[model samples]
Target: MLFRFLVFLYPVIRTLGPATAALLLIAGISLIGYAVLRQPGLWSWLAAGACLLSAGLLALLCHSYHWWLFKLRPHGSLFIPIK
Candidate 1:
């Protein structure tokens, strides 16, 4: 029973956790703008807002990433760097 509950709740918790964290970052930034900057422009606020949203969505997707998604490239010649 306990194991079943855990399994069911894991994905819910994972999705919400990232979303909540993202909101917190956004709120913190807004507070800073209000307190220190006194007042920020609409575009600046929107840019910060976008960053917070993207970060949270990214975090959520990261939890579902497959091991095969992370392929490593071959590394050779430590003395030489090529672009």
Candidate 2:
């Protein structure tokens, strides 16, 4: 679910500059990880949300991805850069 939402939002985010988008994504994931560690019940909530909304949510996610970007080369501006 989280991945789907990220995919659905990434193109719009990339418009703000890919570097900014990537940094914001990294920060957001770090924050979410912290939150989950502080309150483990988040996993149960996530599971419940998944169970309740799986079908329509997945359909919307599939429809939302910007597939055309796949053809654009120089794809080496990696989102998760290697150290």
Q: Which candidate comes out best when scored by lDDT?
A: 1
RMSD of each: 13.7, 12.7
Whole-model lDDT, model 2: 0.48
lDDT of 1 by residue, 34-53 (tens): 64476666766676667667
Model 2 residue runs over 4 Å out of place are 1-16, 39-83
**Model 1 pairs whose backbones collide:** none
Cα distance off (Å), candidate 2, residue 13: 11
Q: How much lDDT does each candidate structure score? A: 0.53, 0.48
lDDT of 1: 0.53
Report the lDDT tens digits of candidate 2 across residue range 28-72. Answer: 565556557766666644654444354344344345444433433
Model 2: lowest-lDDT 10 consecutive positions: 65-74
- The TM-score between candidate 2 and the true structure equals 0.28
